[model samples]
Target: MANSAPASVWRNPIHFLAFGLGSGAVPKAPGTFGTLAAVPFFLLLQNLSDVQYAIMLVVTSLVGIYLCGKTSKDLGVHDHSGIVWDEFVGYWITMWMAPAGWFYIVLGFVLFRLFDILKPWPISWIDKNVHGGFGIMLDDILAGLMSFVVLQALVRFVF
Candidate 1:
């Protein structure tokens, strides 16, 4: 992290949105913080129809590529750990197709955060090996997918 702030960051719009208005600029636990930021959004999306939720997730993921990319670039780093809008969208994607209920929502949040933090196998590998905006976004996407599968399977088995 820079001891001094980058002056030009304020002028960059991608940095503005992606950093959560500079929330990502925090020095520690950026991913966790980013995921925390995602929770309210998850609640909102849960109320929408499945198709509406899916469309929103897709659009966010695509825009996240640019948003995350440009913000990382501005920070003079490749996928800096602080930038977490990607994680937000990833969690949304995980929950979008799932049945809507408070219980499932909490479970999904826990599951998504676990996979996100653990980053098992290929997820951890890619996070280490890949670079750029997509790289930052991909691991969380995979983690979200895994969480979604678990949520789906549970719905199938228990419900």
Candidate 2:
């Protein structure tokens, strides 16, 4: 798939993020790689105050809409599996306000992946119905929100 991707796919800056800094080009489980690629960024963001983190999240998500949309149009594929920026954003959302520690990171990762893959209820609904850049982002956004709720609960009540 990477080999077949258009040259512009690599040349375009937006594609870099949409492709998860080339992690999305990985042949297997690109979404997982994308999520993993997000870890360092998450660590960086973790140091910020909650307000700063929230602002960055909003910026990333807003840019992601255009980045993913343009890349999908360039690739002639809507929400291509190779486009994993959504995963990066989604995982970050899942980790929002999560407790500090590698344990929480792993927990967030696992839970986010489950919700993303399973696409339960509204997530599934949005995936099937939405279109364009917004469509590309909405499902993962929902998954992240759902995962955030669960992770916060576990952090507060169980751990």
lDDT tens per residue, model 1, 1-159: 343324444677677667655656567776666777787878777788878887887888888888988877877877766677777877786786788677887788888889998999899998899877788788888899999998899889987
CA lDDT of 145 in candidate 1?
Answer: 90
Q: Candidate 2: what lDDT? A: 0.88
lDDT of 2 by residue, 32-148 (tens): 888999999999888888898889889989999999999988888888887889999999999988889999999999999999999999999999899888998999999999999
Q: For model 1, what is the error of residue 61's alpha carbon versus the real structure, in angstroms, after optimal superposition?
A: 0.7
Full-model lDDT, candidate 1: 0.77
Most TM-score-accurate candidate: 2
Which pairs, if any, clash in model 2? none
Off by over 4 Å in 2: 1-7
Any runs in candidate 1 off by more than 4 Å, and if so which?
1-11
lDDT of every model, 2 decimals: 0.77, 0.88
